[model samples]
Target: MTASVLRSFWIGGFEGADHVNGAGEPLDMAAATAHLELLNGDYLRAREHGLLTVRESIGWRLSEPAPHRHELARAVQVATAARRHGLQVVWTFMHYGTPPDVSLFDDGLVERFASFAAAAARALAPLHDEPPVYNLINEIGYVAWAASHTNLIHPYVGDPQGLGEHTEASGYDVKRRLVRAVLAGMDAVRAVDPRARFLHVEPLVHVVAPHERPDLADLAERIAGYQWQVWDLIAGRLEPQLGGHTGALDLVGVNHYHSGQWEAGTERRLRWHEGDPRRRPFGALLQAAWERYRRPLIVAETSHIGVGRARWLDEVASEVANARAAGIPVEGLCLYPLVDRHDWGDPAHWHHSGLWDVDHDTPLPRHRRLVPDYAAVLTQWQARLPGAPPLPIAPPVPEPLPESRANGVVPCTT
Candidate 1:
């Protein structure tokens, strides 16, 4: 019997700015591109490797420094190149950067973003008829984590002792505005090509020990609210508490990472690890999500920093397969940063998470080391390709007992 196959690929590089570390050392694009070309080889490389999709983001800051004006030559060059190569593009409107002229907190940021989205959609619609899929913001929770807790980027100062109120408020506002921008962008693209799809990406957060911190339990509920609230507002299931125009998203994008678990009584000691049992597995997360929303799900980003990334990819691909076998509408999985790049604002070398190792002094694909794992994924799923026999499903687990007695023993006579 064969299993279902899910296509895997990646979104590569940030636009406008060259890949750089937290210390601001710029990577050599010429050298990096040459290296990437070898791994995926221009057009033939990616296509032959079986990647059905590619992800890219247009920089709002770079494209439109001022209101209503767009600098699209570079964007057009990239998008055109991707199309010529036969790769489907999922273009993100705002990955992290905002236009220098607009303040995200401002009352009018939503309107400004909508207008910008419209302009972007208008410019890109001619190249493709598939209504453009727009990722309103990448990892909304992580953005808040960086800005509010880690001080990794703008609005650097945050009140950590205050349960991240400032960060939460800021993140909520930015996300609300971003969704509005996406809807506006979709409308704009639809005017040119009416099939535009909107995608919203949020980080997956897991509470490791709910019993330890009562506050964290409350926080967990709030975080889930934050994650899905924007979509609900857009879909008209809930009222818009944040100040932004409302409309439901066409797809929900998930930017899951290895380090998503939150352990109570260990807040300060929380560290990113690969095989933590307390962490919610990606398969479980996706399954619960599919059952809840029943919409198409895409793994927007996943990559490992050290030599273990290959193993990480295997685990993730298997999870995707499992999800698909269980009847979940799993669309794609993206190994973010096709080649390793510098951490956005962290210059201390704190986060070296990428598929390729950047410490090589020259960028190159880690494929030689990673190919085996990639091949394992390919082989596992390829066997399940169309027309192949369906794979057998695993048996379900039994439910737990209802209650216990006072003698530290339950009345279990089964």
Candidate 2:
């Protein structure tokens, strides 16, 4: 399928992760960034800037606080807002967070999440003119790695010392569970609304041995291989018993970030600039994914923080342009966290990673200001890309959020 299915080649992603952090604190990024309180303005800003397609989420923890008990009225409200703003949405059912009673390791998580997925589809199916697109689970591979190999996610919080061979094995086991969850969730949604579409999003990465440690080349290849495991599993190429099939691998989304490539053992990121021969072009990675999956692809998520935002986009846009020109059929590029967000574990620190920056000093309902340079770069790419939305003659100037506006997002149940 082509990008013609989407409203535009540019997509804005709202920061909707509700994952529990390393500190054991549950995070609601959409609420923290004031996106929930300022939904209309946020969606309007994206549409005004020529982005008609967006990625959104309905928190699983909040939507289903207890087993088989779902509260999706608020989620439906959010979907209504998107429809009102004339934007097409790709809703993320889960973003690395599960209910308080549910553990990632539980054999029952797949069924629990599948039930929630069906409930969500039932609530949202009527809002869209076309079949609503759903990203069943965001970054399954990364979530598994974080939970097992690192302490950033649950089941491993405050357990950084366990990052050795045992943890590495655990990571794969967790990945298998996540893949099963995705497959079951896809089936559940289809049962509720057969026309519902799905997007499987995962990190796109490259890895290499440290220059001094040439003997570690094989190890580096194994580490890089983790990136493909999620896709392979969903395609039934790796494990068919999970109920995966070619249909489970729908619109493939590859999220690229500056830290995506690195030296294996030391974890030192390969420089995206300064002539690192080991660094691969983003277009090459996209091509490799297409050739392997033979599925239509999109850059599901990509952005940089502070000073690098525009430059990163320039590189990504160039790579995407080349990929499309070469007949890759890469559909769209989404600038994630359309508005800036704070670090999950350290809410005091803002990433300054979005087209709009949030003011931390302000009280509840913080103000968001546009980054002119980033907008200019985005506009330039919009003009260059075929079938892109028309460039706005002038950048949008966001007004300060009113103090009377209260945070409408459901409180975290965890």
Candidate 3:
């Protein structure tokens, strides 16, 4: 069967994670960057670019601050806004943040997560008549890997020393836990809304063994497979005990960056630029995921750190074109953090990876000024997209919500 593509050819990504930064401090992009306070303006800005879809966070940390009891004021507002703006919402349930009272290693972790996921879906049901789209448990694999492999943040649970340095086993124990959490969350969403769709957002990568360690070529391939373990588990291809079925898995969203390529079993980072024989093209990496899952694929997250913003976007556009040529049904390319953000390790240092950059020293809703140079480049690149959908003369206005939903007792229907 042919893979599916999104209704809109491209989408925008809003940073909404409410997690702590590497320096052991909290980082709620929506709040820190005034996104929450100025959401209406943010939506207007994004819509102005002709984006009919956008990614947002449900703020698990905000809701369920305590066990059982839940607060969903913020989530309700976001869902309503998306409907008002007529934007297809792909909400992120867990953006690397859980309640302070909960533990990822707790015996009831899965059940606790399920309750929250179901609750979020129910709250939005009245707002969204179509099947809900979700990036359930956003980038869980990266969360576990970063915490365990580096001082980026404290490890989630067991193995404070990290499994990466251990020589005894596969070192994928962290990845396994992430997959389990995802399966549980997916089940929860389905229970509440059977028509729910998922986008398993994970980093796509490539690696090779060093010349001196030619014997490690096989080992390198195994390490590369680590990236596919979660998907494989969900598809029930690799681990049958995970309770995953073929139909449970949905679209695949890969977060790719210039530095995603690297040398396995070492600290070497591979270049992801043009004409580098060593550098693998983004299309090749995307094809690997598409071929394995046989599902629609999207470049869910992509951006450059500095002045290379324009060039980087141009390269990604080429990758999207190539993906289309390969019959991969590549749906969209999202520029994450459409607004520039602070560094995770050093909040003082800003990364100029966005089309718009705000002055941190300024006050809340710090006027998202456009980066003229990058904006011009983006315009040119967007126009050059091979299969880009033409912009509608007027944005669609969502249907007026029925009065029955005001009672808050509408039963969800397929």
Q: What is the lDDT of residue 181 in candidate 1?
A: 50
Q: At residue 45, give the lDDT of candidate 1.
A: 49
Q: What is candidate 1's lDDT per residue for 1-414, written digit by digit as tens?
A: 112122233333322223222243443332343443442354344565566566667766666767778776655766677677766667776665666666554545555666677677777777764446667566555554454454344444444464432223336545555554544444445555555666667765555445556666655555445556555645535443321232344566776666555554444323445355556778888877666665667777776656566667777777877877777766667766554544444333423444333344343432322345544554565455322223333211212222331111222121
- The C-alpha local distance difference test score for the whole of candidate 2 amounts to 0.81
Q: Report every candidate's CA lDDT.
A: 0.53, 0.81, 0.71
Candidate ranking under TM-score, highest first, comes to 2, 3, 1
Worst 10 residues of 3 by lDDT: 390-399
In lDDT terms, which candidate is top? Answer: 2
Listed in order, each prediction's TM-score against the native is 0.74, 0.90, 0.86
Summed over model 2, clashes come to 0
In model 1, what are the clashing residue pairs, if there are any?
A: 22-346, 22-347, 40-45, 131-195, 131-196, 234-247, 234-248
lDDT of 3 by residue, 138-213 (tens): 8866776654555455334335564443211332555555566666666666667766778888899777887677
Candidate with the larger TM-score of 1 and 2: 2
lDDT of 3 at 33: 75
